[model samples]
Target: MSVSVMAATAASTTVGTPWINITIFGAFVAITLVVVLRASRNNKTAADYYAAGRSFTGPQNGTAIAGDYLSAASFLGICGAIAINGYDGFLYSIGFLVAWLVALLLVAELMRNTGKFTMADVLSFRLKQGPVRVAAATTTLAVCFFYLLAQMAGAGGLVSLLLGINDKVGQSLVVAVVGAIMVLYVLVGGMKGTTWVQIIKAVLLIAGAFVMTIWVLAIHGFNFSTLLGAAAEAGGAAVLNPGLQYGLTDLSRLDFISLALALVLGTAGLPHVLMRFYTVPTAREARRSVVWAIWLIGLFYLFTLVLGYGAGALIGADRIKAAPGGVNSAAPLLAFELGGPVLLGIISAVAFATILAVVAGLTITAAASFSHDVYASVIKKGKAAPGSEVKVARITVVVIGIFAILGGIGVQGQNVAFLVALAFAVAASANLPTILYSLFWRRFSTRGALWSMYGGLGSAIILIAFSPVVSGTETSMIQGVDFHWFPLSNPGIISIPLGFLLGWLGTITSRTLENPAVAAEMEVRSLTGHGAEGATDH
Candidate 1:
């Protein structure tokens, strides 16, 4: 689209009063801040600050998990992707939802039964502490930082579009503001407060999507075929096929497999999602929570099928690509088309809430890994003064918020879902192998843990840094640069296998043997929730 045509598109979208959107965003911020303040009162201990004292019921924590899991990528990016790419886009929804089954069957209850505050606790239980903790914390920070980037970028685009601020500077400022608010939520309310925000956001998000889905269906006389027919009529029959986005080349097809691997395996290793398991009391609650999360998340993704096609049918793919926020503008634009300004404002607020809740969850998880795993355990040798670790965590939150703001600003126009997939790839590569080994493999050693984490992490980052996603293509983060050497956009296919192999090699090659007794103890504890919450030595 040309500049004149783009301006007309923007003018039409911005016909809904921008101030109304601003008011809605501001009101959400004020209310959530108040909730954070109220939740902060009982955050007097590290357990309270980190795990909410394990007081949340199964259903409550489950709802918060849904809130954290269903990010801006699910609502904005998936819708926009489907609007543009058709069948290929809905694959993201499938990959994300199927990931929960991994969490449920393999990870959730086992992790909750064995670990206390963080995943490091579970890994370091039977292994050497210092090297393992440091490696675990490093990988945790890496995953959380990448995840934060996606949420922050989504915030920037959504707000800039709502306020009609087309300039990059305005969007950067919007991202910075979001980072600051996220920092406050972590510093004050801690996990408890972040959980509340996520619960509220999740409810609003699913509710909002439900209403919009019904509205879109009703507009087409409550017929599913009519909605799909309209989408085909507007775009083409190609919208109904399998090869819309990833079928252009053999390399792109490989990239899709890499992306699928990352998405399906990544959630099992995500630090923020892993930390959520600690918020509940027992293995049973963790199991219940995952079940709840799976059902709720599945229902919401079904809504996306309607919402995405609805946007494609009503807004048209070309216009969405030319809109203020590019592909990320689909859901909000669909709202504007369906109910004008009022619906636009409400939908925008919900999207921002999704961004805020997810970022805050990521922030707290990153900070906890640093303070709990690195500072308190590695640096202080588990003898840190009371309340001092939490103080250090608060400081780390500020530093992380700053970096997330800068990173988000740099990757403004990228798709939030694609960015999240990169995070997933990193998680799958760096963390998943180590986690599975520690929990299930009896001979997994500290050397094995360290090797798997650093090898997987280094390879994933190196590949991403040199991939077309970063510099080669027009839509790359760094446009006008051709430094990329990697052909594939995602590195999961290469890095994830390397992680597993390195772990096995390091364990077998280590001169010192691990104690069989400790491994057996861990197996018993992991399987039967024996000493998770009660054990204080970790």
Candidate 2:
């Protein structure tokens, strides 16, 4: 049958195995919950709770990192994007993969060496503890919330598609269930449990993608060129060219650059990914983790390229878009086309795992930021009662989960990858410049840190709120509203530079430089891992 005919039929009907999908998904969740229970046996101290007691090996931690990094955006969004936009859609994969070099060379080992638990730990090392920690924690929570929204949205779309629930109420219930599960994971497992879940999810996700990739290639005689030709014929010859998505208007081209910039710089600032480094014991292990993660993530992105085009060739974009879950339905639908209801069930399970794991990771990171940084360091004056912090963290987890559920429900139809890009823009704007300055510049002051974080965060948030993403267009979150003034959907192009500029300006204009002796100690510790282990517990 022609691809169009096949897709047209399947578009109106789901794979006809909601029970199978639910059963498979339920099994995975039960298994992971057991793992979390077992892992929580070691949650004795703040370090144990937040950084896994630094017990994980390099490769293990690396695998977990890949799981945390390759979010729903990478799987569902990018696949659907490629199925629709072709070459331009693959740019997200490129930007995401290339982002690791920044993490590896600039942040990974250095971060692991310098700080004990959170990103705020590193930022507050030499600077004024109170102000810097507040700024850092605020930004951390904001980034986590944004990232959480993407994962929750993906969960809603993925599950709703599987069960054939097309109503807003059904999708919202799906998102809430996901949020509750994520809360359970973080509240029970803490970092150690979350890390283990991430590792298992990483293995399953990568393995599933590999199987699908090979199956697709085998059917095409293992020739990529053949796959591409078929895809072009199935969709259009224009699928072979650039600008299918981004070249429509000058504004779109600029938006592409903004998206690329956000993706490239965002990882260095992602709190959950940064926290992954703390799971390992030594700086060397941290570097090794990055190396392992790079290989794994790079390989999986390659699989996505094939998977994307394969979907385009096997099922036309129009049908994929018309289906439940909108664009995010492409991968699951492709699985159904290739291997019927069984593969669809399995793929749906893996997709659910992807969203669940990432959200759990983000939730714990946010919880840690608040309990450790704000409540412990700032509010308690660095003397939180032992065990009290974790209690606070558990509470924060529930609150964050509730907020994520509401936010996810608000953003149902948007592409998961595009929403993730906005999160990246905020991370890049609010955190990266401050982090780079704190590591590299001796004159970088507490004033600079505050300026950079707040300016970047404020600019990014204000611009996003005023941009077309929130209103003014058909695809926007708010319909029948036309208040958008910012032309680009993403604000990275302006906010990122403003962050850097503000940091520089705030530093040079300060009447006082940070104590030179403190700066020297930080420089020595950050670069050489000297005194980093004996560093203050906070």
Best-matching candidate per lDDT: 1
What is the per-residue lDDT of model 2 for residues 397-424, given as tens digits with 9 covering 90 to 100?
9999999999999999789998898999
The worst-scoring run of ten residues by lDDT in candidate 2 lies at 7-16
Clashing pairs in 1: none
Report each candidate's C-alpha RMSD, comma-separated, in the order given. Answer: 1.4, 1.8
What are the per-model numbers of colliding residue pairs?
0, 0
Query: All models: lDDT?
Result: 0.91, 0.90
> What are the runs in model 1 whose C-alpha is more than 4 Å off?
1-8, 12-15, 536-538
Q: How high is each candidate's TM-score?
A: 0.98, 0.98
How does model 2 fare in lDDT? 0.90
Model 2 error, position 387 (Å): 0.3
State the lDDT of candidate 1 residue by residue for 1-538, as single tens digits.
7785577575644536889888987898889899999998999999999999999988999999999999989999999988888899999999999999998999999999888899899888888888899999999999999998888888988988888877888889988988888888889899999999999999999999999999999999999999999999988989988888887789889999999999999999999999999999889999999999999999999999999999999988877876666788899999988998888988999999899889988988889999999999999999999999999999999999999999999989888899999999999999999999998999888888999999999999999999998998989999887999999999999999999999999999998877889888889888998877666343
TM-score of 1: 0.98
